[model samples]
Target: MSEFDKKDVPEERIGLIDLMRTIKVVPLVTLHSPEEAVPLARALASGGVPIAEVTFRSAAALDGMRAIHDQVPEVTLVAGTVHTVDQARQAVEAGCKGVVSPAFSDAVVDWCMGSRIPVLPGTATPSDIEKAYDLGLRFTKFFPAEAYGGVKTLKALSGPFAEMSFLPTGGVGFGNAREYIDLPNVFAVGGSFPVPSKAQRQGDWKAVADACAQARQLVQG
Candidate 1:
């Protein structure tokens, strides 16, 4: 049995979904080294955005999460690019408050469902959305948003899945972030654009902070 029973979990609490919506922008990050995690988190918070989805695309994910969780408790953290229950469990143990997958994985979703852990599975098509709906999930991540038609596609999805909400990632940037946030169906936007590769690699935390501040302004405005 899981640590938290599904039936015992209350619905009134301000959960991950609520936090994501409130933040309006979630930085999708992949840390190259654990040493960068605390500074990177500080940059995000200083820039006005205090949430990050640390991806498992790199081996530094767990350590990076630990660094931020231990040093920057103010920044909300979630695990991204998770592929299995083990990864999800590790992420939770490492201090991530939620889990996000690039693709819907049955095992991972099931584990989250049973454990009452919040998860935003990726849904790129009608079928994928239906699967998520059937699993009782109302919020999901629309991935590779640009390639799948971006705003146009999300507009269409709203017609049928009216109650469904999304955090559209991939190809999202400062150039068109306002367009996505304007949509009622979109709860928030996720991408690495706010943390530019050049800035992160060069340890130019101010640049990252500036980018985050700009993104927050786009969402609020």
Candidate 2:
């Protein structure tokens, strides 16, 4: 069980909270061209999921974020896989309102918190959650959630760190997303499901949109 906080206080910033609550399904998108970013974001938004985590796994991350920010303004874009302060700075300048990482990094978390970007710092253990809570962050991402025990772990964690809200990513997909979404402590769950690799590689924007629509319906229902 993770020993962190007692409860979460909802944030006023929609983009920030979307990183937690509404974006229960996040598209971990990595496009080859920045041009693909806007269209993809538009598709997701039109399908009812108005957000995405544009990861730094690809060279086009910043450019994609810029394009999405400019052309698909309704999509709440977040910069992900931030490993350094400079990257975080660049992401914020590119119009990302939030940041996420695959693992916990105090420096990265501090940088985002210091800046205007609200952060969903990853926390997979009790200690990680403690550090995040100490930094005044109530929301966090539980990377490799399934491998680390998933719902059972979260339920156990709630007994101690009930205040901390989570957005469990890694291994999250259509089959089990609702199990996480229904949890009071889980504000959201993120995965590559919204834009499956095969679909994106095939340039199936419609499939992406349809997937997002189905995901939205599942979470809502």
The candidate that achieves the highest TM-score relative to the unseen native structure:
1
Give the alpha carbon lDDT tens digit for every residue of 33-117 in model 1. 9999999999999998899999999999999999999999999999999999999999999999889999999999888888778
Report per-prediction Cα RMSD to one decimal.
Answer: 4.3, 3.5
Candidate 1 RMSD computed on C-alpha atoms after optimal superposition onto the true structure: 4.3
Judging by lDDT against the true structure, name the best candidate: 1
Instruction: For candidate 2, report its TM-score.
Output: 0.91
Residue pair clashes in candidate 1: none
Q: Which stretches of candidate 2 lie over 4 Å from their true place?
A: 1-15, 18-20
Q: Candidate 2 — which pairs collide?
A: 5-163, 6-163, 7-163
User: Tens digit of lDDT per residue, candidate 2, span 51-138?
Assistant: 8889999999999999999888988888888888888889989988888888888888777766646778788999989888787777
**Deviation in angstroms for 130 in model 2?**
1.0
